[model samples]
Target: MINISRRIQVNAQSEANGVSLNRSQVWEGLVSKARNAVPYVSAITECNIVEDQGDRFIREVVLHGERLQELVILSTEQQVEFVRLSGNARGIIKNVIEEENGELYLRFSFDFSLPGVPAGSEKELEFATGMQNSYLDAVRSTLQTIRNKVSQ
Candidate 1:
């Protein structure tokens, strides 16, 4: 399995524009992404909430042209976790909110393995690199979307 982790300061750019996102705003954005990721994730073409159970929900999303089902769990304003139920990747992906020196940060972490790829092969490394870049863009886009929402 390969693990990829990345984080970005949510208010880094927005603060200069006088639009910093608070904990609740970021949390709501995370929840919105969990429900309908089409806007936040460019790779996700479609999203549907299969089931809702207050703090957790099951969603089916078409990501990178592959239909995937995820069990999404919300941890109030702290974190949101997506566990892949059926997809090319297996394991969990997390979106976490952190505070440091009075600044807010959003962290995206992935722990998963491609079914047929060998752990220490070149192909795995390539996939990991590409996924890391793709996810980083997604995280940035998520924050930008939240900022736009907050400003409006």
Candidate 2:
């Protein structure tokens, strides 16, 4: 079995505060946002309180598109971390976060690997790449929803 993980980091500078969002808070917002997003995330998805034990999380989403069945699992267990996806996705950093002369920035990371992938196999790369692209899009949509809900 191949180990996969990915994450999106955002140096969110809220108009009211510039502190990093508490990890648990961020995860909560993510799960809430995803739950309401539908199809891309929808109500049927599974997100857990502890994904890997020790300040980590697990978000599993089942989506249909790209002419294939897709399953995405993202594990954020490290500080300088990334959300990892597996099965058909390589994992990706979808957004970039940074402070440019006192401005907010976000950096997203994505990565993944397929089980039983033969060495030097292009098919494996395809699976990982395709999933990364699709999942990144999902994350972006989900984040936007979160932001909107929070501001309201």
Candidate 3:
């Protein structure tokens, strides 16, 4: 099993206040947005809202792939109460977290199973690469949509 992790600081200064919507608030709206965006979720079968605990929430999302077929993910809203998500294409991805002063952070991590023999099958690598790019693009599009809505 090989894992890939990416952590970025969206805003290093005043990121806390920079996110027009609070973490929990984002989670609230995210559910609907995700539902509407399901078709674009790559391998997502469904995103079922499970729990909302004031500061955090949980969801069960099913991801599909040729090799794994389907992967059920349990995502949670973590620190800062930001949204967390998982799926087949990219595995698990966590959104913004740990707001301090005015700074905000975002992290996305994924776990990919490398087929043993032939040193990680070539097909697995191709899927991983495609999914990784798709995940990043999806996040960017989602954020841009949010920003546009807020600006209006």
> Rank order by TM-score, top first?
1, 3, 2
In order, the Cα lDDT scores of the candidates are 0.91, 0.44, 0.48
Q: What's each prediction's TM-score?
A: 0.95, 0.47, 0.52
Q: Which lDDT tens digits does candidate 2 get at residues 1-152?
A: 22333455443443223334434444555544432336334433444332444333444543453212222233442222435443344443333333456543334555445556884488866656665566566655555555555456
Poorest stretch of ten by lDDT in candidate 1: 11-20
Question: What is the per-residue lDDT of model 3 for residues 37-152, given as tens digits with 9 covering 90 to 100?
Answer: 45445466565556555334565665553322222222444422223343333334444444666655456566655434243677777767775776676655555455455556
Poorest 10 consecutive residues by lDDT, candidate 2 = 65-74
What stretches of model 2 exceed 4 Å from their correct place?
A: 1-44, 48-54, 57-97
lDDT of 3 at 142: 53
Per-residue CA lDDT of model 1 for 54-144, tens digit only, reads 8999999999999989999999999999999998779899999999999888999999898998898999899889889999989988888
- In model 1, residue pairs whose N, Cα or C atoms come closer than 3 Å (at least 3 residues apart or on different chains), thus clashing, are none
Total clashes for model 2? 28
